[model samples]
Target: MSKSNDAISQLTEKLPILLIEDDITIRRFVEINLKRSGFQVMAADSGETGLSLMENRRPALVVLDVMLPGIDGYQVCSQIRDRFPEVAVLMLTALSQDLDKVMGFEFGADDYLVKPFNPLELVARIRAILRRFNKDSGSLLCSGSFRCDLRAQQLFMDEREIELTPQEFRLIKVFLEHRGQALSRDDLLNLAWGEDFVGDPKTVDVHVRRLREKIGNAPSTGRIETVWGSGYRWREGS
Candidate 1:
């Protein structure tokens, strides 16, 4: 793995992110910001490369650009949604056309961003999406032989208390709250970091690893399954 990949793997163990933009300058700029915010970022300069990386890296979230040489952002987003339904996509476009936005959403974009946007605001939006959509509001969650106390922001395994960092606690809470559902890195990012968050998805992965360690779960035990071409999920009866 390259240094970037190593960094991403480490962070995905906490946070994992993918950025697909044809513009080199913008890609580098966003990658820098995301890395600084404690995320692992994977970058591809074209829609084709982006899609290929998505298949191999399985990033939690994807930042896709609308215009590209081969596959446009809309087409790419649609492909991801169809093949990797769990992955969360955020479409970036220069056009402000309402129809364009609608098209992005229709193609399964979780969020949309116009050019010349504030990086900070983008980060915030990412966090919001993760919080709202990553979590399953319909079901209660249990993990590590313990149940989560959402009201108290605590985890209990085997009747013993396990302390969790605020981020870890929140991540686990989301998983438990949405038990049995797969949450993409973007989903976690939107929930934990916010929609406008410029951070990388690797940050979410790292946090997840820590969460698993704290909960006494193995990474490959199916407690938290990695959905190839998508993100992660907290499986029931793992």
Candidate 2:
């Protein structure tokens, strides 16, 4: 097996991948492929069932479909972000429009894939997303008044913990790592969302804005300064 597949297999052994798709055929196809890929799989037919599974199973990642019967994928993704900010969500949909992809990201999906996608590609994407979360597991990333415990996956400002969605946490982690440097949208996207991410650069702006709101304008939050015509920078020092 490839190194990527090896990583996915190891990660999924402990935490199953939750599959939420209303279409029985697609659901089973994905479930079989995932199991073949050496992943632990839990299948759900509806968003409600998926969320319920999330409560108990606490899967490492959710493979969610957008066209569920009740409480569409966006709502499910939003709820996942609100309740389980640590879990990664990958939205599967037939809608191939850019707007739909952006909507998924806005609703807190870690990635989006349209229907008719290759099961192999789906596995690769899952590996990529989970890999991003698992990277940098040993050490703390500290800058200004922010301190991030990499192993614990927690961020604190002024020694107080701050709640963050997975995306937000990744963004801040990138910012703290590259303080005082003007990181362009592409740079931030590649660092935080991974180069495999398919979405708008505006998504970076939205996340940065939200992170700013959560961290506030306090000098300790390490002022996120916008470089005109460029991107953003984390001010050096507290």
| lDDT string, candidate 1, 1-238, tens digits | 5985455345443557789988889888888887776667899998888888877778777889999888899889878866765567778889987767766655656677899888876665555554443433344356546677665555677667776644566677767767678788989877665555654455665667666666655533336667787888787654
| lDDT of model number 2 | 0.86
Question: What lDDT does each candidate get?
Answer: 0.70, 0.86
TM-score of 1: 0.54
The CA root-mean-square deviation of candidate 1, after full C-alpha superposition on the true structure, stands at: 13.5
The numbered model that scores best in lDDT is: 2
Clashes of each: 49, 0
The regions of model 2 sitting more than 4 angstroms off are 1-9, 12-14
